[model samples]
Target: MNKPLLLQAQRPFTAFAVRATPLATLCLVALLAGGCASPSYTITPEMQARAASENPAPPKDDDFPAPGSAKWQQGAFPSLEALRAMRTGMGKDQVRGLLGFPHFSEGLAGVREWNYIFHFRTGAGPDYITCQYMVRFNADVLTHGMYWKGAGCADLLKPPPAAMQPVATVRPTVVAPAKTTLGADGLFRFDGRSLDDLLPEGRRKLDALARDIRSDSGSAGAIRVTGHTDRLGSKPYNQALSLARANTVRDYLVQAGVPAQRMQVQGRGESEPKVHCAQARRAELIDCLAPNRRVDIEVLSGQ
Candidate 1:
């Protein structure tokens, strides 16, 4: 009220904004522009390899290989023998399971080498392997692919040998046991045509005898085991082999239910042969070689 406060404050009024420095403004614009740049980028070969080095990359088998471009036919698969079993021109699916995926392709047909490598668990470290298979194709169809794995890859190209003998279960029946007594030497000689093919009864009887003796200590006293074989092989070998078999029978008997302390074992191989031809055909052919190959187990009061 005193003269309308004639003092209109004498302070000056200035603009409310502070101007930015050119250098600072320039820095800010540059940073924003850099951040807004495009994310799209072209990957170089070297960059791709660097990334691959950090992680393993799967093998490539996409489009059909160019005819002249060195490429092994089909995919990696099983053993050469197994692959050879497949008919020519088989589809990829037919041989898929028989052999697994092809490892890697080698060069073109002429001396082309492919290694379908795999690992097997053995005593040693992983069984390192590389199998080179040769595939010969006529036109577009695959004629035949010589498959072999491991060293000597070229060998797989050849034909495998035919099995001559009746391998596995196809073997001929050389001897079928029957019950028949041999010479008067108190031995067994079963008709096996050969000494090697002795029946179980000859050995099983001794085992039983040993068990019976072992169970009863009284029988263990004066235990005498006599062994015999068919009329084959040298006197010494046959006798020794017979004795060993007899001892084995005795040991088995002892293990089954016989006392080791009260047991005796012996052998007399091939000293006797099957005099009774008829009995040799049956399962209990022991009588045929009873005297020849046998183990006489006698228990007496004295050991």
Candidate 2:
């Protein structure tokens, strides 16, 4: 080779060799670092014994029904609607008259507990019903308590998943399961007229509910708002209105950062009518068509 050609070839070869050696060294270092290394640990006999020991937590005090105040409602067809509407600290005798004999009772600490579970069959529309009440007492008087639907007892202490939300009913069959019980469920007659009416106070309650949801760091699972109509309206209209009401609340939560997936809404229209005046719904207070116009909210945990 000529001098210039030989020089060029030698220059390229030298550079290639220099880079190859450094690249090989870097790969070796990485391979070594990727391997695991264990630090030394020692456990003495006394240390091992201490580590194996376990202590169970003591039961915490339950601050529900007060001392000597427990009373319950029992028997078939005992007017669950009436009981559900009663106050948390209502008198025991009052509940007895509204619901009938005591099914079962238990005592704890200085207080007593009264439990009621009611079930009913559906008639023309909507099938199956379940109700539960957990009441506590003191001085033979009602003190503190809560209600649950289906097996919602555990819910009083633990909430459900965040992603599991209530939403608009997809169809008649797409009914959402119960999450909790309604506090005051009956005496419907809606004294106020206008089937599509939104109570002036409803906005306030809604704002409060939304505040609770947002303040809870989006913990409230779903906002279930149902809109209903008297038998006078068409099914489609009722369904649409029910959906709109539910979405109105659901959207508010979303704006407050609640996940959209955490909510569901439903509309039964004239389906679940309040049965007290099954024959005629007009005359009675909080009449027979009451069930058609209500919404429910429930919360759950997430995976």
Q: Estimate each model's TM-score.
A: 0.28, 0.31
What C-alpha lDDT does candidate 2 achieve relative to the native structure?
A: 0.45
Question: What TM-score should be assigned to candidate 2?
Answer: 0.31
Model 2: CA > 4 A from native: 1-198, 217-230, 255-261, 274-276, 279-281, 285-288
Ten consecutive residues with minimal summed lDDT in candidate 1? 175-184
lDDT of 1: 0.41
Instruction: Give the per-residue Cα lDDT of candidate 1 at 51.
Output: 25
Quote the RMSD, in angstroms, for model 2: 28.8
Give the 10-residue window scoring lowest on summed lDDT in candidate 2: 180-189
lDDT of 2 at 282: 47
- In candidate 2 the C-alpha lDDT for residue 80 amounts to 39
- Residue 201, candidate 1: Cα error in Å is 5.5
Give per-residue lDDT, candidate 1, residue 127. Answer: 47
lDDT of 1 by residue, 1-303 (tens): 755454443222222122335666776554342222223345332332222223222223332233233233333335645653543333333333465434443322332222344332334764444444333322222223434334554444344432333357653333211222223223233323112343455455545443344334333244556666665445555654555455544445444544455566555456445454456455456445444554455665643
